[model samples]
Target: MSLAALLDLRGEPALVVGGGAVALRRARTLLGAGLRVTVVAPDLHPDFAALPVRAERRPYLPADLNGQRVVVAATDSEAVNDAVTAGARAAGALVNHAGDATRGTLRFPAAVERGGVQVAVSTGRELPMLAQALRERIAALLPEPGTVDAWAARREEAVRLPGAAREGALDALRADIRSAFGLSAGGAV
Candidate 1:
């Protein structure tokens, strides 16, 4: 599923099952989106202690899944990760299992940010390596932040135009944006 389908995690209870670098990255991402995160792991990076998050220095337990909207399992131990995934699933919370996308309820995507727009791409556990590569290429081809703003500004005007005229106007705007970014015709970033 696309990240857009998930509800905004703001103010939601989220759990991370590790305190390592991988888990830290996930925690930072969730925190950036305004989730109330709780990290459960025996050890934590020193930098993590400075972050504004709840930390529990203990092995993960089923109780950790309580009241969580999302769960991320990034622990070093595969067995623990599996257990966390299972527990989160049993709780009906969306879960992302690091390095085990097939077993998790959701997979995080590499996102491209353009002004207020965020484009996220996923391979559905089929080709993550390819997805990463495509993400880099898409990042390179994305128009400047101003272009996105311009597009948003023109959206209302386009909607006011007649049907065919609207399509043509949007097409022209898309072409101009793509050309400004040096992208080929019919190729989307």
Candidate 2:
């Protein structure tokens, strides 16, 4: 079974071996996570230029996998994707095949961020569309970004409450969160 966990990618070097829409999407997500991303492709779509990533206009080289913590293969060519997977494994880096999960060991989940809370949904690569649908459903149940500061403030005060009142304070915080998000008391996202 594939285990689910959140990784800290800030400041880590990552390589993306494509310049198409799939590669662009993966690169954007990685860049958003603060990773130092370098994308290698013979030709790039115009949209890629807008992102803050190091773009190398060249064919992917196996050596490009070196020193990378993560590598994403989004090339259209199966041979090129295979080469990237092998190179990433040999270099001890995690590999993601954007076209198909069976080609690599890593896959990204659909993510939703709201009010300082982030939720990710994975269907084990069985159905990406379902994961995205689930993410959308969960996003609607989360508090808005503007409410995050208030939630944090409540948490801070609750953490300092006396032991006897701690649980009640925490429960009240949860109730507030539920009310703000239009979720039922038993709802979970």
Candidate 3:
């Protein structure tokens, strides 16, 4: 079964077991999510220089997964990726295998974010192109980055109201959203 979830992995530690293009992409995404990522590979990719990651230009060690919250097995060798998967399992960390998604427990879905709001689409990693297309469509429909921020600021004041006052404020906010986003009175997004 596939479940799509938006996780707050900020300040968590993650490990990438490769230095190739796939691993580079995974590392960037992890960093973007505010993870403290460490990449281990025999030859660190030159592109990793710009990213804020602790790069170790050495072969992967099972102990590398010791304190990682998430792991990505993106090494070139299938056997090595399998080893990384085993290590992640032993360390009780979520693992994602780049070469074959089914072997790993986690799937990185197509995602878009504006302020604190995030939308993700996943086809169980079976049809990535479709997921990408859906993500693109959704991205185009999103409001500007600070639009959600502005709404959240208003929400902070609305929640402070007492009893029925709070309900009224919230109702107004809902109507504002519907008006701004061209949503129906039924509250469909």
- In candidate 3, which residue ranges exceed 4 Å CA deviation? none
When summed lDDT is taken over every stretch of 10 residues in candidate 3, the lowest stretch is 180-189
Stretches > 4 Å off in candidate 1: 1-7, 160-189
lDDT of each: 0.85, 0.89, 0.89
Each prediction's TM-score against the native? 0.81, 0.89, 0.90
Candidate 3 residue lDDT tens string, 43-127: 9889999999999999998889888999999999999999898778778899998888888888899998866668898987489
Model 1 TM-score relative to the real fold: 0.81
Query: Which candidate tops TM-score?
Result: 3
Report the Cα lDDT for residue 110, model 3.
90
Pairs with steric clashes in candidate 2 = none
TM-score of 3: 0.90
User: Which of the predicted structures, 1 or 2, would earn the higher lDDT when compared with the native?
Assistant: 2
Could you give candidate 2's per-residue lDDT for residues 6-61 as a string of tens digits? 89979999999999999999999999889999999999989998999999999998
Candidate 1 local lDDT, 9-67, one digit each (tens): 79999999999999998998889889999999999988898788999999998998999
